[model samples]
Each structure stands twice: as C-alpha cells, then as structure tokens.
Target: MNKTAVITGATSGFGLAAARRFAAAGWNLVLTGRREERLAQIKDELAQTSVLTLVLDVCDTEAVQAAFSGLAAPFNQVDVLINNAGLALGTEPAQACDLAQWHTMIDTNIKGLTTVTHALLPKLIETGRGASIINIGSIAANWPYPGGNVYCGTKAFVEQFSLSLRCDLAGTGVRVSCLAPGLSESEFTLVRTGGDQEAYDNLYKGAHAIQPDDIADTLLWLARLPAHLNINTLEIMPVSQSWSPFAVKRDQ
Candidate 1:
C-alpha cells in the first residue's frame, strides 16, 4: 500500500515543494494551509494523485483537531508527518518589537507546532509500519542574528522538542527529525519584511540561496532511509551562505 503523509503549510515554500515531491513518489497526501485559493491551486496541480486539502490555520487548536479528525480513514495511519508551518515576524530587537507580531510568531511557530505534534503522536505510534515526523526548523536556532530573536527562540524550541520526542518514542516505531535550513528562497523573507518586495529581493541579491526544492529533496532523502535508520537532525545551507549572517553581502 502507498504510504500517507500529512504536511502542514502546504500552499507554499518548502511545504509545497515537498508535497509535489511526495506525490510524485506515490504517497497519498493530507495537505493543510490557511489560504483556500492557494490550496485549491495546489490540489488542481496534484489532481492526478491522492490528495486531500484542508483549509486550516495551525494556530487554531480546535480547527486543527476538527480538520485532522475529518480526514478519510486512510489517513489515520499516516506514515509521515511534516510540521512545515512557521513564520517570522520582524527584524526588530525584542525591546522595540510589536507585541502583536511577537505573539503571532510564537502562536504559529511554537504552539502551533506542538499542538499538531501532540494530536498526531498516537496515530504514529499505533502504525506498525513505523513512522517519521519531520519538523522544518532553522539555523537561526543556533546562530542568532539581528532582528531574529523570537524567531530564533521558536526554532530552538523545535530543535529541542524534536530531540526530546525522538528520545521518548524510542523503540516505538516512530522517528523524529529536524531539518534546519538556511537562506531558502521563499515567501518567508517577504513575510518577514512585511510585504516589502524590494527588501525581500535584497535578501538574495548577491548570494546563492537554496531553493524550496532543495529542502524538499533533503526531506525525501531523510524519509526514504531504511526504517531502522533515522536521521535525527540535518542543517542545510546554500553554498554561499557561511557562518556569519552579517558577512552575507547584498548589493545596495
């Protein structure tokens, strides 16, 4: 039987790329996102495959539960769960930050991730075929930069949480991994810059940024590994990206 995979934030970025890759690999998909139109577009694009689109805002716990509960019986034994839903609010220092943006970041990046993971853990454990939970994290968790305080903190939570989950699920046929990526060309920078196209463009001006497909390829590689072998954590950055964030030069 083809395996089933659930991916949050499936409308764009790494999530969207992963959805396409997995569908091509013959896995049934349960894709969730907040934008109905984008979700519909993705559904139409992947219409040839087995795909279920759920219009879900991961921040809303009740909505997440209801949406996942309504999934067709086939999805109950999901073989992979990808927590790719996340966001970054601003580049401001913590003291100068907007409270609303900070809260939104925490809600989506931290609480949202935890809630979905908790809700799906039982099903993963019960599935005798063994399972994988891939959490999309960031290198910011390890190397902090200006204006990345809360975002970094949230990703750090993901790193720690993934490690803890792996330990707790030991020998339970469940594997947890964190795929921390750097400088990927996605709406992430656009959203973080508050719709400033120029600023977003400046982010990748001089550097070779990793495309969403690159991260998706990494995820597929991790998922396809032998059942007994688990890749616990992976950090991927573009070749041009180096240790120092400030050293990344962009044309003015």
Candidate 2:
C-alpha cells in the first residue's frame, strides 16, 4: 500500500515543496493550509497522487481537531506527519517587538504544532513501526540572535517537545524528529520583512541558502529511512551561513 503523509501549512514554502516531493514519490497526501485556493491548486497539480486538501489554520485548536477527526479512509491512516506550519514575524528587539506578534508566534509554532500532533498520535500509533513525525524547527531554536525573541523561544519549544515526544511514544513505534534549517530563500523572509522586496533581495543576494526543495528532499529521505532507524534531530545550514562573532558593548 502507498504510504500517506499529512503536511500542515501546505500553501507555500517548505510545506508546499514537501507536498510536491511526497506526491512525486507516490504517497497519498493530506495537505492542510489556510489558503483554500492554493490547496486546491496543489491538489490539481498533483492529480496523479491521492490528495485531500484541508483548508485549515493550525492555530485554531478546534479546527485542528475537527480536520483530523473528519479524515476518512486512506487519508486517515497517516504514516508520516510533517508539522511545517510556522512563521517568524518582525525582526525587532524583544522590548521593541509587538506583544501581539509574539503571541501569534507562540500560538502557531507551539500550540498549533502540539495540537496537530495530539490529534494525529492515535493514527500514527495504529500505523505503527514506520510512523514518523517531522517537526520543522529552526536554527533560531539553538542559536539566539537579536530580534529573534518569541519566535526563537517557540522553536526551542519545538526541539524540546520533539525530544519529549520520542520518550513518551517510546514503545509505540512512532518516531519523532526535529529538522532545524538555517538561512533559506523563501516567502518566509518576505513575511518576516513584511513584504520588503529590497530587504529580502539584500539578505539573500549572494548567500546560497538552503532551498525549500532541499528541505523537501531531506524530508523525503527521512520518511523513506528504515523503520528501526530514528533520527532524533537533524540540523542543516548552507555553507554560506555560519556563526557570527559575539558582540560586546563597550563602555561609553
């Protein structure tokens, strides 16, 4: 039987790329996103694969539960879940950042991810042995930087949550992995910059950052790995990206 993979935030970026990648691999797809039109387009594009599009906002807890509960037949038998619905809003210092943006990040990245995982755990356990949960974490989770604030905190929570989940689901044969990526070229930067095309262009001008397709390829590999092998955490960064020198403030 062809395996089924459910990817959240399937409208764009990593989620969208992963949807295409999995579809090409002949996996049945349950792709969820806030954009109904885009989801429909994706479904149509991957017509050869069994596709079910759920117009959903992962931040909506009630909707998350409803979406999973309402799944029928093959789509309901989830072999892999790609928790890719997340974002980083505004690049401002902690005190300068808007409280609402902070809350939104926490809601989507932490609450939303956990909500989806909780709803899908039973099906994953039932599928057993080869089941997988790939949480799209970030380098921000491990290395703090200015203007990261709550977005960083939320990702850190994802890493820890993934680890704890593995411990809790130990005997269930459900594998949890956190995939943290650094410096990628996607609409993610556009969202963070609030659609400043110049800023987006400048940031990635010469940086051969990790692409969505690259991440998608990684996800495919993870899903195809042997049932007994589990990768707890995998961090990938482009050669063009690396650690910066620690900043020190001089006394004036």
Candidate 3:
C-alpha cells in the first residue's frame, strides 16, 4: 500500500519542494495552499502521482477543519503531516513593529500550525502503522536577529509546541518532530522583505544558504526512518552558515 502525506503551504518554498520529493517517492500527496491556481498547477505537474489539492488559508480555522474533515477516504489516514505553511511578514523591531505584520506572523506561524495539527492528530493516531507530524520551525528562535522579534517568537512557539505535542501523543503511535532551518534560499526572503529584491539579495550576499531541496531531503530522511525510531528534532543549516546571526556578514 502506498503511503499518504499531507502538506500545507504547498504552493512554494520548502512545502513545494517536499511535495515534489514525496511524489517522486510514490507517496500519495494532499497539498494545501492559499492560491488555488498554484495548487492546481502543482497538481497537474504531479499528475502521475495520486494528488489532492485544497486551496484554503491555514489561518481560517473553520476552513481548515472542514477541508481536512472532507478528505477522501483514501487520503484520510495521513501517514505524515507536514505543517510547512508559515511566513515572516517584516524584519521590524518590536517597539517599531507594524502590529498588523506581527499579528499575521503569529496567526499563520503559530495558531495556524496548531490548528492544522490538532485537526489531523486523531487520524494519525488511528493509523495502526503510526504517523509523523513534521513542523517547520526556524533557527531564529535560538539566535535572535536585530529585527526578527515577532518571527522569532512565533518559531519559538513552534519548537515548544512540537515538544509538548510529542509528549501529549506519547503511546498513541504518533510522532512529532520539528525541522528548524537557518538562512534557507527560497521565496522566504523575498516574501519577508516585501519584494525588495536588493534587500533580499543582500541578506545572502556572502552566505551559503540552504536550498529548499536540502530541507526536503531532510524531511524525507526523517520520514523514512524506521517506524520504531523517531527523530525528535533536527536543526538544518548550510555548512557555511553558522547557527548564530552574529556570524552573518551583512553587506553595508
């Protein structure tokens, strides 16, 4: 029997990379993103694989519950759940922050993730073979940057919640793991910098940022581990990029 995996934020970034990797591995994929057109494009591109696309915003609690609840029978028992849909609105210090951006980050990165995980936990627990929840966190939680206050806080929640969930799901044949990445080369910087190409480019001027595929590869490894073995947490970064922002060389 083929395994099934559900991924959020499937339209781009690490989520898109993981979806492609999983499909290539012959896993049935249920992908959700806010953009229906992008989701449809991915679905069409991966037509050779069994794929389902749901265009729903994770921040919409009601929509999230309904969409997951309505999964087709075959897709209902998710073998793996990847909560990869999140964003960092702006690199603003807390005192000078845009409250709207802060709230957006909190809602999507923290509340949205928790909502989806809660909705899928029952299905995962019921899967006799066991299931895994891979939450995408950020290394910013550990090494705070100058203007990453809200984004860092949200990721800190991800780290904490993953640990708490692992404990809560103990003895239930469900595993919770967090993948915290540092300085990844993806749409992340573009989105976070609000399309300021120069600013985004400057962030990685001299850094070897990890690619989406790199993170996807890590997810695949975590998923393929022996069912008896659980990888509780993984912190991934490019060899040239240390965990601390203090080591990052910002272009003047």
**TM per candidate:** 0.95, 0.99, 0.95
Residues 62-167 of candidate 3 have per-residue lDDT tens digits of: 9999999888866987999999999998777788889999989999999999999988888899883558999999888787878989899999999999999989
Candidate 3 TM-score over all chains jointly: 0.95
lDDT of 2 by residue, 135-171 (tens): 9999999999999989999999999999999999999
For model 1, how does the per-residue alpha-carbon lDDT over 141-231 read when each residue is reduced to its tens digit?
8989878988999999999999999899988989899999988899988889889999988889988899999988888888888888888
Best-fitting candidate, measured by TM-score? Answer: 2
**Candidate 1 lDDT trough over 10 residues, lowest sum:** 241-250
What lDDT score goes with residue 136 in model 3?
97
Model 1: runs farther than 4 Å from truth? 245-252
Q: Listing every candidate in turn, what is its Cα RMSD in Å to the true structure after a full C-alpha superposition? A: 3.6, 0.6, 3.2
Q: What are the runs in model 2 whose C-alpha is more than 4 Å off? A: none
Query: Which residues of candidate 3, in runs, are more than 4 Å off?
Result: 243-252
